[model samples]
Target: MTDTVLEIKNLEASYGSVQALRGVSLSIQEGTIATILGANGAGKTTILKCISGIVDPRKGSIHYLGRAIGGKRADLIVRMGIAHVPEGRQVFPLLSVRENLWLGAYTRTSRVEALEDLEAVYRYFPILKDREKQEAGKLSGGQQQMLAIGRAMMARPSVLLMDEPSLGLSPKLTEEIFTIIRRINRDWGTTILLVEQNASIALQTASHGYVLESGRIVMEGPCEKLFQDEGVQEFYLGQKEETGVERRRWKKTRKWA
Candidate 1:
């Protein structure tokens, strides 16, 4: 049986007085991709932050490989093999692409492994290699996203938490990013927890899914079932399931039918 790589119980977090996560709990199995679906301010990003130690949970337990990790330092989490590709592709604008990638390996003690990982990242995103010397700000949006993922990969993480990776990209670029995401998971046996607003793509990409609303988990199931859920179809998937009357009306109005 595949082991649970990360687990959370009753996770809660907030900003000032505003609660962002309310008893949020989930688990990701080894070598699988799990996605959280929600709208903006639904606390999707906050969950990722809590996992990667960017935001400390107010009340909860976060476990990685059966060890508690909540409230740890962010850099310590990275060193513990959890790398976060945050929302908005926060690459250092003034730094060279190579420089930004190297920063991901700051916790590693071995220079040789870091070099090898850099080459591996280059292989994953050859565009980054081509733009190695270029300032990160000079690259296009898609390239910058690639750079962000590559930087995270430099940490050689066991679990990768990706937040809105498809955000701000064209359809083609989004597809490209997800393709690489799948490849990373497949090739490296990486357990991934993806947080996304694009429900359609997120459903397609992940094996298991959770739906968050108002800082709480509203639903969860296998991706296939979640994709077919009426609420999910209507709200998240942008699909309106027609009632019998509506279907009849639609059929009646279709001259070609």
Candidate 2:
């Protein structure tokens, strides 16, 4: 069996006249979390959009579990066992927590298997069970994020693409959410491709890392190597005044997307 769960080569995508992903390529091994770190408008999200088939790649190929999927439809991709939980935690605000979770299984082939997966999700996140009847919008930010993940879990995906899972969250909540992500990876063995601007924690969680700058991969290696490098301080650790004005410039540049 191929150790690589996903492979992207010569990926290029554009919206109108504006190019987003530019000749990007990446490979993700099965049963590991691989994070793509970059600043806002750096095309991190565009990579996810392309892989999930939200935007068709203008050029290049995407292979999922050895099957070419670059041109497939988004829904078709999800049913193929790739679930994308997009940037904004796009939950159904009006729907009940239970209803939102149930909707995730809409594409599943068997209702019984979907129900079994729902139970598994509840085991992973008991809060969703506690708030089963609550309106999704009424939940706290952390609860809402949990619901978003829970909804994705209901789809029974083998590969989970999470975009900015900790966006707009408190530090405590971010830690909590990342802990769940770790458990999900270790326990369920689902391969994950996480896109985030929070490089510090993201690198710590991922087995390997890739650093993206303005739609291109500028650096990539072992997570520990990138973690200790001085360059990582530019984006991950925040800049330093001792390094002078050029280094000070990073303080103003928004990294979050």
Candidate 3:
């Protein structure tokens, strides 16, 4: 049986007057990929922020490896083996690609281990190695996304929190990025909590899924079931199921034409 690596219970967070997460609870088993599906302003990112200590929760518990980590310092959280790749691929533009990656290892105590991990990141993204000395801002969107993931990997995290990794990229590039994500999980046995707007890809990539709406978890299940759900089909996948009456009407209208 797999162990629960990360767990969140009754997670509540806010941004001043606005309540972001409302009693959110979820758990991820080790070596598995879980996904959070939601629309804009659905409090998905807030959950990540709370876990990573970027935003303090009003009330709740976040446990990683059986240790309570909610509201801990952000850097401390990273040192505890949870790494977050925020949305928008926030790589330092003026910094060299190598420099940006090196910053991820600041939490580590061993220089030699960090150096080895840096080389591993280069192996994961050879393009980054080719441009190690180049300014990060000079790279394209997909390259920057790779840089972001690679930088996060430099920490050798046990749990990777990825937010909208496919944001602002071509279809092909999105596929490529997800391929790397799968590779990372399979090779490193890293647990992943992915928050993605692209429902089709998210459902395909993650084994378990949770749907969020207006700061609450509305549905939770295996991705296979969620993919076939009528509401999910209509709302997230943009593919609505045709009722018998609707199908008959469509056939009648087609006959007239």
Candidate 2 lDDT score at position 203: 92
Residue pairs with backbone atoms closer than 3 Å in model 1 (clashes): none
Best by the lDDT measure? 3
Local distance difference test scores for all models? 0.92, 0.87, 0.93
Per-model root-mean-square deviation over C-alphas: 5.1, 3.5, 5.0
- Candidates ranked by lDDT: 3, 1, 2
What is candidate 2's lDDT per residue for 1-257, written digit by digit as tens? 53999999989888899988888889999999999988899899999988888999999999998999997999999999888887878889999999999999988989999889888888878999999999998998788888889898888889999999999999998999999999998988999999988888899899888888777887877788888766777556685447565655534654432
Supply the global lDDT for candidate 1.
Answer: 0.92
TM-score of 2: 0.91
For model 3, residues 1-257, the per-residue Cα lDDT tens digits are: 99999999999999999999999999999999999999999999999999999999999999999999999999999999999999999999999999999998879889999999898889889999999999999999999999999999989999999999999999999999999999999999999999999999999999999999888898999999999887787678987456675443333221111
Error of 1 at 226 (Å): 0.6
Q: Model 1 over residues 1-257: C-alpha lDDT tens digits?
A: 99999999999999999999999989889999999998899999999999899899999999999999999999889999999998989999999999999998888899999999999999999999999999999999999999999999999999999999998999999998999999999999999999999999999999999999989888989999998887788678887656665453333231211
RMSD of 3: 5.0
lDDT of 2: 0.87
